[model samples]
Target chain A: MELLKCETSDIENTEKYILKNGEKEIGYGYIKGVEINPIEIFIYENERSNGYGKLLFSKLLEIIKEKEAKLLTFDLPEEQYRMINIVAYSGGRYISIKNGVRRYILPIK
Target chain B: MNNTILKFLERHDFDLSLIKKKCDLGVKSSKDVNPIIAKYYIGKGEEQQRIYVADIVGYDYSYMNLDNSNIIDNMSYFYNENGDGYSTRSLSLLDIPTDEIVYRLMGSFTRDPMYLMEADKGKYVIDSNGLHRLHILKAHYLKELSELEEGDAIGHKILEDKYMVETMARKVDYLKTYSSFLFQQIARYYGCDFDIRPQYDDYGELTGKVTIELRGKNEKLVLNDKQFIKLLKDEIANFLNDNSISKKDKKHFIDFVGQTIEEYDSFKEYIKQNLQEIYNECFSDEVEVG
Candidate 1:
């Protein structure tokens, strides 16, 4: 239930979590520095298309705002259409697409 | 020209039976059959030449020559050729093997309008055989063959060599580690405890097989075939959903899943269908009770 920042020491733990929970690990976003933040919001295999992604993403937005980060970004290379729809519904801005990876950014007020 | 090669093949002490067997195993064309026969018939003298062509196409004995010399016209022929061909002449003036030359020829055939048409219509083995050649060529020849992008040529050469070793050689110990890794991943996903160690057979044949020993008490869930299928399907679905994989990868994954399901289902069905015969064959030592 704890929302903690992922550190260099947590690499193995994060990998294990990713493997265990599958796409649900997307909710655990990465914070790079004072200015940049990257968030991942996963749609679990069984729970896909059930509005859980949006709820988790909303929580991620709240976290980004709390962190006072300048730029917020996330990449959804797979399931682009579904991700795009979710991001658009959540009022996130579209960023550039490069190397088959789609990036979306939400500015913290 | 093909006839000439065929005649040469016949004249040599080539194992026609083996060649015929290879052809039957989807080798198909005369070009593929010839080199395999030639390798057995005339080893070392033509070894380098065979290696050169195999390095280009990414498979052994699955290609044939279209017999056109004009580079433009022959692009289709080269694209269509599925197996390896041997030529004493180095492909380039620098005396290097002609793997790159054939690779590019195969690549251009797929991209060019005329060649693509032929490939789409199945006029050639362009999809399975030519498509792979085209990929290797494009990867290596995005620029001129000389200005190859990183690992392009080397990658193609490796694929070619791997195929040759897989199909032609009596033993392929080199690929054991790679195959082991793949098998381990598959076994782990299936929730089966297995160990695969490499060892040679009595004839000194280098072979590798997984020794899957079921660990722990036989759980009821594992014993249920229907549950196993459901678990497999769920795991596959999760894997596909988790990875941001490409379209081509998805196709391959789906095909793999289908094949696995079919194999397991068929095996189970065979056991059920032949239960009485199998019981008689194995339990004949037991005292018969009328």
Candidate 2:
């Protein structure tokens, strides 16, 4: 996936990273804070499963690691099965389930 | 250490741990050494907290503790390994609903209104507890939004997806706003002092005299007037040579400055007085004026 970095000349607060495969925006993703958690992320609908989610997860993890937070917990909505699958496939462990959302915890080390 | 530094650290709740560390570093016995140690400890705490030292001024609140009812789960709360509250600013700017805010102070003391942000941490209160904090947030948000590519999405309140743009075109009136406060904070980070005051007129445009002071004695530290003037002229020349500034503004300022060059009294003073007006007209968030 190609990364669309924010151009300082035409600065944007939009998605920090716009994921694309060739000409199409296969998916777009950005970090959202739940608390100080960098575990919050969004991935758009797409069928291409070429490890982009893993790449995106790793990128987001790098940012969180730079923060004071050591480990990040992913609060994934149950409906987003692809994301859940990606997280699980990438060694994300089920931390807990609460309020209709499943939380996955990962140590960024 | 001066009382100011001691009080600053104490107010922020960093005294105990920081003092402990300073003691470990052989700081206690050293006379007049608290400020140095305090500065070191503050830097360490600032890094450990993952909060930007710059954003220290941008947020204000009182602490409710890790177990406080005010603490919400899954929301990003930042402390300076201490307090002064936390921010998850990417969500939105300050939305404090209550006027009274509760903050945590370590050590024995009754709570009263104090600095929105203490030097070493201490307090976790509402982001809206202080007016200065709110003002900082507003200016910050404006500056953030101003540079973003959201022109088509102007007035849209959505911050995440589209990243809201400047909606106030003609309604872009604000108080005698300027950048001195920000400058001072940045200067402090660099271990210096800066004072800035800029006046504005009834129309929300900058007016009257402006004062800027950067305190230092070293030769390199003192700002040279001629060099600064030359730099300003070059920057403005480059800016006007490029996109967006109205020709009318460029010429009006030029003509006004030129007319009284020989006598160089009233009109020159007027031009000098109105430099900020010209700048605000050219740069402040408003419809481009010719």
Candidate 3:
């Protein structure tokens, strides 16, 4: 699948998963609060394993820190153990469970 | 020609009356008589009056009279090169020849405070006298006046002014050095590599660009210009949620970001107007309709 980089506003129909090419969007990440380079990464099931999750998580971390983030945190679904593993491997620590979702943190220097 | 007789007359404090009487007897000049003429008497009595008469005659006979004295000597008694009056008592301190006494007196008189103040409001006091003292003090003690000449005084003034200019220039140089250090610290904090270039304008302003190079593939989020702008707007909105920033300050901050990215002013205004909406859409949970 061709990786299409578009603005958040350009992404149409949030609910409908539009499948095109061999690349399925594993997850979506968005910049969050302003404690410097903040980002929230969401992993989708289709792009799980195969190192895409790890690659995506690392990319998000690098981008956020370069954007001048002092801290980066994200929410991972409690059931997504693989995604949780990937987050943990990327220097993320379990912060707290909020509303049954596990929150993780990666402090950017 | 009887030196013994003249000496006997001087020892007894002979008046001009005695000198005139001795002169007819053919005893003319006396080194002894010269000393008596130079002697100062305090009270305005007959003895002092006699001394004055002898001085006038001695001056005339030796051609040291007011009109006939060397111009420098004539002027030296009334004024110095600095144009201050000379007291005979003051001249006794000099070790120079009798004729050169005028030169030494003028030098001392020129440095006198009364003359200096009347001449130029202490400009000479600071530039000439003060600098001389400062130089001597730097040398650990006062130097002899013989060692200091007119050329040295001018050089001292020039050196002082040069020192002042150098001190000021050094301070500016130090400030510029400190500013670059602070800039480096800030750039490192942002996780961006920056090369701080010298600022040319006044007020020591610095200008440079920050390069955010992604370290690994898929390891970071790279955004286009539009996405980056939108992300900035979201970040600003989040910051303002509980911040005490005024509306004007918020607008100014938006304008500042726009300027940083070289965007139009109108774009900043438009982004600021829609910041809240963008935040709500991006961050708020949506209700899924199947």
Candidate 4:
């Protein structure tokens, strides 16, 4: 699987990467900010339960580490149950819930 | 109906006639009836208490229980057992009490009603919608009550000043993107990094003071001139033509900013002299022709 970096213009310090398995785009993920990276990952419906989500997340972590960010954080809606497990698997800890949006933080060493 | 809920309705002086039983509404679904007066079942079987939602508008009448102490102080953004899932954007409106909502509430009745779910046996209610309107109303009531009770004109004046400060803070926040971009351009021209960090009070409210830092290329802090930068920002905001303020206030503001420009010019001269000294120390001998 190759994670191809995409050019971003509108938002500063935000990076997007598209995941490809033999030229077939399976999913994409992006991380924004430098000191604290607010990351997001997405896998197509047809690509579910095949570990592509984990792969995409791990690849994004590499980019975050390269940027020397202190931690990875994201606000997750309660309905996004599938991503919860993936975040939990990657040692992401629940921080707080505000207005039905749960914040999770994964410390980057 | 449970005895507790019945007494709650009585205490609040709700229009009990408008409340129809779930089945008595004569609708195929609960959605067909007016949601404000519709009966909802809280729990299952015997524990279930038939409940009615109340539409409390600040215009018509005020409920005693929904005053400063109960509804305003006890409003929670957290999720309760009732599962009223309000978005963060909707819930965040409770942060600042603005005059716009108050004017609307006093002018006419609006359909946007705050949905409060009875929690902990009707002690407090979790907030759902129309939080901003409810906050502004309750805060205004609280302010009036305080003025009456204490009879302190100075205290009332302080409240007025605080309100002005809060409004200015909000205006600054509204112009954050443009002001920050402008600051970035200035920073780039000066070969430094500019960052504006907002200051918050004990309650996490914006205090209208921001720390404007100028950092060197090595990320070391060079200057921390927040007051000067804040004045500059206000001057820039005024230049952008924010006519929401009164004409008298605008004239006073322009006069205030006119003095700041002289202060800024002197400040600029100081920086230029300092840079000239640094240039002499570093590159005086290195200059061969140019």
Tell me candidate 2's interface RMSD.
22.9
Best by DockQ: 4
Off by over 4 Å in 3: A1-4, A8-28, A33-44, A75-77, A98-101, B1-290
Report the lDDT tens digits of candidate 1 across residue range B1-290: 23433332344333434433322222222123222121111111000112222223222222233332212222332322222221212122122123444533533333531111010011121211233343223222322332334568786565555333111111112122222323334445446653333222333222233222245645322112233334434544454455454545545544553343344343223323423332232234642221
- The candidates score, on chain A by TM-score, as follows 0.58, 0.65, 0.58, 0.84
Q: Which docking band does candidate 2 fall into?
A: incorrect
lDDT-superior candidate, 1 or 3: 1
Per-residue accuracy of model 4 over B197-238 as CA lDDT, tens digit each: 443333333345444565543342222235444555554444
Residue lDDT tens for model 3, B63-165: 2123432211232332222322222223233233322323343443334311110011111111111111121111111112213345688745533432221
* Per-model root-mean-square deviation over C-alphas: 22.2, 24.4, 41.0, 20.5
Model 4 regions lying over 4 Å from their true place: A8-13, A34-37, B1-290
Task: Enumerate residue pairs that collide in model 1.
Answer: A26-A40, A26-A41, B32-B61, B62-B82, B62-B83, B63-B82, B63-B83, B64-B82
Position B175, candidate 4: lDDT: 29
| TM-score of each model, in listed order | 0.22, 0.24, 0.22, 0.28
Candidate 1 per-residue C-alpha lDDT over A1-109 given as tens digits, one digit per residue, 9 for 90 to 100: 2244443534332211121244234344433342222544455565454455666666666765686665455554523645654654464433222233444454556
Q: What is the lDDT of residue B228 in candidate 1?
A: 34
Candidate 1 wrongly placed segments (more than 4 Å): A1-37, B1-290
